[model samples]
Target: MGSREWSIEKRSDSFKAEVLETLSETGCLSVIVLGASGDLAKKKTFPALFNLYRQGFLPADEVHIFGYARTKISDEELRNRLHGYLIQEKNPSPQHSEDLSKFLQLIKYVSGSYDTEEGFKRLDKEISQHEILKNSSEGSSRRLFYLALPPSVYPPVCKMIRKCCMNKSDLGGWTRIVVEKPFGKDLESAENLSAQIGELFDEPQIYRIDHYLGKELVQNLLVLRFANRFFLPLWNRDNIDNVQIVFREDFGTEGRGGYFDEYGIIRDIIQNHLLQVLCLVAMEKPVSLKPEHIRDEKVKVLQSVLPIKDEEVVLGQYHGYRDDPTVPDLSNTPTFASVVLRIHNERWEGVPFILKAGKALNSRKAEIRVQFKDVPGDIFKSKKQGRNEFVIRLQPSEAMYMKLTVKQPGLEMSTVQSELDLSYRQRYQDVAIPEAYERLILDTIRGDQQHFVRRDELRAAWEIFTPLLHRIDNGEIKPIPYRPGSRGPAEADELQAKAGYVQTHGYIWIPPTL
Candidate 1:
């Protein structure tokens, strides 16, 4: 369908069912971000919260923000560090400056140790004071604790929050916790982590975030699949040849190798982000659009995926990665990996779902390419005919386009590739696309688990990749080395060829401009 015909306004009814409930029940809300001085807080968490405030999503006077960390810095100093990262471009308008100042006024800082109960008690005092000031009429006050810290501290932080920071009574507002990705290195660790947190809070109160689920394009997958009838019949293995979900980053991890080296690219991206995207692409239609219903379908697809074969996987480490001071000298971590997943379901029994992700590659992009089966019979004798392919771009630009073969615009009557495109920049020029974190944070505030990962879903995903991960970690396999600016290891190309993926040379995608 064209962009104009399938515009959000035109299709609002189809998607609106998922957002039936509102979050108006919560009264004065207090958001406390742990590891406030960390990179994740400064880069994503604070900026997303500020965007929510600037857009008037949060009640200006009633809502309060607290930054908790071990660093001994004044509130003004913390705000100063955050101000540079907030969405203020060079030479902003006076109104923008005023809005930023007002948002900063709501944020307060609390310095404390994660393991110490005294610090948490003091932090709770700060929150309680704000609750008393804003919610004097006995209305419930909501508390949201965002753990922007590492996984090592998650257990202690959860314990401390339950002991010292949880809501005093259910009569008022309830409390929620937001956690970031890389849930664990393996299945056992992930389950252990979940058990630790499950003892303190219910599953409904824990938001295991996968930012990829919040992306505009990723969120649109449901609308494109279930809401649009044009794709229903052609979405299975009968007509589709293969599906490729690829993620590439142009730059290397310069100073962040300490964290990246420990997790590697597979644990960092493939296990969580790319795998979530695969579930969306291969899942069956849910009975309803509710959070749990959608998640139930996602889990089914992951369960059907066969264990990844060792030969079907190709791992590579970027050249000169050891040069980074943070990376261990003898580290054999893989910066890139391509693995094939076969779903043994009725809908996708024979189709191959190729998941490839890498850093320090030839380009920066994230896309899903679904190649369809060739035409049963052809009348035109053209050597340049291309298979029908549906492409969804998730980053660098957001778009959905289908490549089809059409007669060339001449008397020669040759077939050439053409597209029916829906570029977001061109179609929704005036709308400001919210960041992934922004959408996810709002979902958490509203208690919407549709876009977040469930505990069982996390386990199912781990079950599919944990065995392969163990093989790599046990030194049973070694990663091939490839140049920083190259595509990836040469073996990756050979793997694609064996899987029957055609490479059309000299074809490039140009992102649409606003």
Candidate 2:
């Protein structure tokens, strides 16, 4: 529903200017995968492109993919590395092998250093040759550069692209870059990175991707809140007591201990992934579904968030984390964090938005739980059953359910807990949820910014967490120790209880089956 062109009646001059700068969807496509030899390109980026290939989104004649990195591998070598990474279909067709072979043939590899013009010049030459062969000699080609690389190298890589690899075509041809996150360590660094990149590309030309926004359940949030009349009148502080956005992983950072320690749980999850979720759940309805309109509301909500109070946060490090040779012996980095964010807006005044995330916990799941306020005058004593909670489970099984108080099915008139469940597997048996990267990459191709992070939005997010992160970096704050395979430090639960969150005991959600 959101992919439509802006309503002609509501077009602003700025919007018209923005639309003109984007590439024509009909131009020849050149997709360059930077850091293509790395794990991300091999596992996610290439696989996603292949999916688009089989679905005919990438016409064999018009789309050519280029793998650019310093790995010094031949095109055939790169194809062989990626062949095993693509997820094979459960059942294959007679022509599946032939289709796979053809798709592999379309990719070319360009080897070079990220900071030098030598590599980028070669990349540009290859792309230009392809464009000219396809009748786009005058620079009428669409160029997309995906950086599946580390944050430390983004500056030089971006500079090289800006210097030597941008498209020369002016007739509806354009160049855009997609960056993975950890945009920076804090507000100061994040602003600097933004400024550095801003000098090279317009905000519209930079796509800052956060994969969580592409999740099937997260994408449904706006429609679930705004399109349903039943929720319109009951979604504010008056009806809701506390909101909990939680992410838990059953295992430790396996082989990522060294990398994970630099940016703790808060940076890894809460700041980008969970906070974006909070904005969608709490923002007012947009004027229209236009990308700018939707993003504008998100920025406003983030700006309204108050500073973090030290007393409202709990940090923990798991027991066996230091065992990883990569982790420093005296590291105080947190593997778990539960933070309360209070928005100063009228819709959520005095309500606590708890953002919790952790690694090496009791289970693996990401979810949002909205617990409604208790009944004013309790007639059926529903308090015994528990406060009404609306839960949106994001993974393991994609589902949304509302826990309500209802009478037992027997002659007894007592209230009991019940749920109105909508499990995606049960309800849509024939549909396969697209991988988050696949949907996001498609959005980048279609020139949709609704699901991508905006610049000011990134700034506001950093503004909320930078001060707290600094305290942790210094010795002012220390992470409490907790055992692996257990819920985070007990202090976290105490903090939750102190903040008006009442946990409902003895109730679990079980997905309904065939």
Which number leads on lDDT?
2
Overall local distance difference test of candidate 2: 0.89
Pairs that clash in candidate 1: none
lDDT of each: 0.88, 0.89
Model 2 Cα displacement at 405 (Å)?
Answer: 1.1
Error of 1 at 505 (Å): 3.2
Q: What would the per-residue lDDT of candidate 1 be over residues 1-514, giving only the tens digit for each residue? A: 5576567545554433333323345567889999999999999999999888776676576689999999999999999999899856798788888889999999999999998898899999999999888753343778999999998899999999999998887765889999887898999999999999999999999999989999999999999999899899999989998899999999998888988988999999999999999999999999999999999999999999998989889999999898999998888789999999999999999898999999899999999999988777666643245677899999978899988777779887667777888999897875678899989998887788999999999999999989999989887778999999999999998998787677654356677666
TM-score of each: 0.95, 0.94
lDDT of 2 at 376: 94
Quote model 1's TM-score.
0.95
What lDDT, from 0 to 1, does candidate 1 have? 0.88
On residues 1-514, what C-alpha lDDT tens digit does candidate 2 reach at each position?
Answer: 2322233323433643443334334568899999999999998899989887775567777789999999998999999998888647666665777778898999999999999999999999999888878777565688999999998888899999999988765777779999999899999999999999999999989999999999999999999999999999899998999999999999998899999999999999999999999999999899999999999999999999999999999999999899899999999999999999999989999999999999999999999999999999998877866899999999979999999988889987877888999999987664557788888987897789899999999999999999999999996889999999999899999999988999887688888887
